[model samples]
Target: MLYFSKMDGRRWEPLQHDNQSTVAADFRLRPKRRIVPCRPRSLYHKRSITMATTPRNPRSKSGNKPAVAAPTGVIPVYDSALMQERRQRILDETRRVIEENGIESLSMRELSKRANVAQRTLYNAFGSKDRLVGLVIQETYLTQLSRMKFATAPDTMEGVIERLARVCMHFGRKRNYLKAVMDLYFAPTVHRDTITMMRELSYGNSRPWLLQLEQRREISPFLSREQIEGDMTDLAFSVMRKWAIGDIGVARMADEAVRGFLVLAAGATTGEAQARALRTLALRKRRAAGPATAVEAAGMADMAGVE
Candidate 1:
């Protein structure tokens, strides 16, 4: 007799037989096993598991829910009415300090104290002292520049001259503050943003007036709008800078600015506009020379009488 073992899927099973023929017959009587393929887990299933495990409202206490917290790292927008009033107050105080004590005397500590704000608030609002002063200049000086009108004068070249004269007068009224501002403006280490803001304010205010001149055909067709506007703006700024630096009196600044404008306009006009510009320049030159000529002639007469 012989006995054999065979695997029956889960375990081995013994076959009892009397001979080798019986053992082969027992092995053929075993049943076959079936296999089933496995399916993969899905994204939704994983998320469901995560949600089931995570605590809902982790920060909330038992029974009552906590208030939602504000998101971190968000910058605040400064355009609200309250923020605008605060900003205006800060600017007004800055202007007052600069006008009363000069720009050199201005300090963030003093300004904050005067404005009833923390020193950190000043830094947060303006980033730096240069920026604060630049804003003051823009708000005070540039605002006036933008509001200037030729109510009495027509939309002609003469109106432009009057506007320049008014600008010189305005600068003269704030000599101390403007002088300091000019020094800072021309400094080698001044912030580029400050320079850009000042330049843009000037150029922006001038553009509308220049556009009016262009529409009226007072500006030359040969020159681009940019060329005419830029030339005139540069001339006006140069004159104002001279006045600000104490290099010239307000009267002289006005005269030089008017002359420069007329000269530039003369080259940048055609037809009747060109003739008018030339005539204005010639008349100014004659007026400027008249007194000097009279003085020289009087001196010569005195010399002859003495002789």
Candidate 2:
């Protein structure tokens, strides 16, 4: 036990102590620092025992390791696999919303709820709803285009024409996708990526087939390979755009597109025999597709009225 009391003139007299050296040892001990407001550069944290030996995290505001800022903006992208999955989930939900309700009806808050992503994360991923919609539309266009594989360049002109006709008929069956492609086509400003994609699809995918047509002398001498490709691309787009918006039915759109390509190919055929041969095969194929159902018959009547 040790005890001290004031004696005189700022001098402390020991009332009771076993050894004076114990008092000197007590004087040698360092006092623990009390945490207080730190410099602005350093955040508030538990006061450190050793300032020289370690670093900044000790001054974290939460009294833990320094918090990392969540990622912001579109480009470099999310590093967390979980966050990446969340972003993709948002995109998939957006696509489903677009497919079911259309892009105009999509809402960030509703989508955030559906996708289990915070609204902030969606904004960080896409910048705006329009940008997100544009990406969805582009994905849609590419997906539909993927169904029309432009890889198989056939040896026969009819084979190529048949495949091209099927591309239009594919759209004819998937009226929704056709409408989406047309929507992108008519409004290039909103869906610029889709426009770029369509253009790329037209040339990069279709040109090789046209070149093959030229090599086989299946292209009309009157029209260059360029003209043939351009004419058919424009014709299919024009007809499909009408079909997409319900100006024409699937049957009429397919009829026009297939017939238009046949007429174009007719000009390019090397001989009447080959021309007749291709036209015969096309007609046989059409018959094999079965008799015009009531829908087709009604569509035919509509075409006749228009004519």
**Candidate number with greatest TM-score:** 1
Clashing pairs in 1: none
Candidate 2 segments whose C-alpha is farther than 4 A from its true place = 1-84, 107-109, 118-134, 137-174, 202-205, 215-227, 268-307
Task: Determine which window of 10 residues in candidate 1 has minimal summed lDDT.
Answer: 290-299
What TM-score do all the candidates reach, one by one?
0.62, 0.52
What's model 1's lDDT at 190? 78
- lDDT string for model 1 (63-105, tens) is 5665454332222468899887788899999988888878889
Q: What lDDT tens digits, residue by residue, belong to model 2 across residues 1-307?
A: 3333344323333333565334443432223346796587546566668657655442347666675543433344679998778777887898887667655567999999999878977776777775676666566556765554333344444445444555555545555545655775677475455455565565543466567666666656677877767777787788888887678877677667656666666665556525664665466467765222233333333332221
